[model samples]
Target: GVGAGGDMPNWMTFLISDVPLYLIAMPVAVVLMGKSTVIETRKFNMKPGMFFKLLLMCLPMMWVGSMVGSMLSLALSDGEATNRVADLAMQTNIWNVVFLVILGPIFEEWMFRKQLIDHTRKYGEKTAILLSGLAFGLFHMNLFQFFYAFLLGVMFGYIYMRTSKLRYSTAMHMIINFNGGVLAPWILTRVDLDQLDKVSQAAENGNVAAMEQWASQNATGLAIMLVYFLLYGAVILAGFVLLIRNFRKAEFYIAPEELPRGVRAKTVYGNVGMVTFIVLTVLLTAISLFL
Candidate 1:
């Protein structure tokens, strides 16, 4: 039925599937989890600047994970995964932006960050963060996204722990999503592809003057593109430096009920329910590659 539905417009399909999952299914799941357990849902409250700081701190891990995922996707599937992502990006309209930018971050943080952290945090902060990150990655059920999602999950989880406010993480998530899903594609659409091709051809022929002229004619667009890439690159670079410099000074938390490290992780994740989710996600990820 899902495969058959692929024949429909991407917007329609997204509305039918992603919309309900975000708007309806996720909140119900969260509520059910809260009722089923004694654990209270995680909440957070922090100034907006803190999220930017978190983004900077997490950028290195996020960059490495995304790079690894991309290379693996290329090597294993010959970039089929990336092509599918690009196709989806090209299909984005207002509806897609709403889901991707607003609803998605809110619901996803509620599930992967809030729910997981709130439940297992009594065990240990480190364990809870790690497990939530793992669950977040696996929940994506796609190789191209799993790694970075996990990294971001850890960052978001930590923020939630600190502030106990969901709004901070939600805002951060929305910022990242908007940059990728809205700004990047919108900028790409504004670019003069024909001019870019000419510039490429000019460079290949060793005509620096022609290349300069082409750039001059499209100065405004080229400047916008340059600023975007530079700002993006600088954040990742700063993150790499900070991550390495502070690697050894990382914090750890002791669980109220201390267990062996392995036992602690097992207690958190090695349950029938979690194991079933892990299995299903792995199966779905494998199926996605072929599809």
Candidate 2:
């Protein structure tokens, strides 16, 4: 049976509720994209240092995009969409882990980064990257993640264009997801939220001594929690600094024949397929933010 009362398993539930579009749309994307398209975008090899350089460059942009999304979530909504991740975390199982950290990245990279790039790269690389980013961001179906996903979509598309390999993008995606899903959750378990609540209560009651006592007792846990956040912040800061310092030095390849900006935009995204996807995602995002 799928569940105690014959309900679907958590993984199935997640797949159905979260990503049914990917399941349905990918086949249509495939039929729409014939075999020759895949061949033209075949993955290529790159030097080891190049991969790290790209990672360092792109990771900071992703962080900035996420921060922007967070601000937008705070301003435009009650963060209900972003907060849903906590609810999802409660239902964690092997399948969720597999899908989140492994299968999900692979499949998404293939569809959004790989297929989209292949489908549009012939027209213009920059246009392809922009379109891929838009699709990827909108695919998240919420304002809380749209900015970051879109930025990452562009970065992933660029990486694919540079290396021509799905593995590079997939590995980067897995690394980010693992840190967010696995490492972050593990760190949370090490922190004592109940104790913090108690401390808050004591302070509210004007019990400074009790608050101090609780803090002293839980000093080690507090230190660990503080250090964990500090470490993450430091890494993001360093990555941002490095990315900015190297921005102009980063490589850009020339397209075969550059289209006018308007023509390029239309060539990549002004079609039934692109418009339908954009409208669907925009509607869903609006619902998530407003409803």
Candidate 3:
């Protein structure tokens, strides 16, 4: 989901709605039949100091990614990008920024990285981790985003794997998203609304070259951004190396198929609910782009 509506916190909205539905359903059949299952946080076996180290390392990487992405969004996504579709975006809603930067990472990390990925990888180890990252990336529709999301997913996945703690990667993700999704909007709000109009005009007219020229004219801000990128990327790279060097290997968690048969359905759904969820996810995602 693209998150909830109104001035209410998206998480609160989900807690009031989706969480209840999912929890009540329990995917009992899946748990019972044992095809595959979500991660049980209580089962996590973390090594000492891993959580602290991961948090220390990821904080900077997340900052760098966020800053760079925001700068790029402002720089490259000016008027001509997205085919003059900027008007359709939720520029006025600060929640857009919050959701993209904060809420989004938290939920995805909780769902894909912490739940699905964790479940698979805990059982199969690195192979499972890789598959989880792949699934996480591909789950985002369209080719343009696949490559970027995939790479980011791998980085976060590896960190999650190394730490065996959700907190570290979740922090990392939130930081990375905060700049573009949150901070940028905050900054933009302070700027004269005329700039948004200017941006919209440039896009609506398909004047990409003008947008580029405008960015060049504001080279000071852009240069500050470039420096930020280099510094942050460097730190994240080092943290990644450190995580790898510190792994204490353990046996993978057993998959559902190996568990006892259940009285519940093999999955949360037969074929019907499964298709419906996927369809709804895609439809909502498209609708989000419009918002």
Candidate-wise lDDT, in order = 0.73, 0.72, 0.52
Q: Whose lDDT is greatest here?
A: 1
**Preferred candidate (TM-score higher): 1 or 3:** 1
Per residue, candidate 2 scores C-alpha lDDT tens digits across 1-291 of 011112456677566654655577776776776753433544569788877767666666777887888788777765554444433544546765786788778878998887877766766778878888888888777676788788888888888887778899898888887776666676666656678788788899998887788778777877877888898777777778777787677466656555677677776667787788789878877776665
Best by TM-score: 2
State every prediction's TM-score relative to the real structure: 0.82, 0.85, 0.47
Model 2 stretches astray by more than 4 angstroms: 1-13, 35-43, 78-82, 90-93, 209-220, 256-258
Question: Predicted candidate 1: what Cα RMSD to the true structure?
Answer: 3.7
Name every residue pair that clashes in candidate 1.
Answer: 43-164, 43-165, 44-164, 44-165, 44-166, 45-165
Of the candidates numbered 2 and 3, which has the greater lDDT value?
2
Residue 253 of model 2 has an lDDT of 61
Estimate, for each residue in 193-238, the C-alpha lDDT of model 3 and write its tens digit.
4554686688779977766666666566556656666765676677
For candidate 2, which ten residues in a row score worst on lDDT?
Answer: 1-10
The positional error of residue 86 in candidate 2, measured at the CA in angstroms, is 4.5
**Per-residue lDDT value at 14 in model 3:** 39
Superposition-based RMSD of candidate 2 using all C-alpha atoms, in angstroms: 4.0
Give the clashing residue pairs of candidate 3, or none. Answer: 29-265, 29-266, 29-267, 30-266, 30-267, 79-203, 97-181, 122-253, 123-253
Question: What clash count goes with each model?
Answer: 6, 2, 9
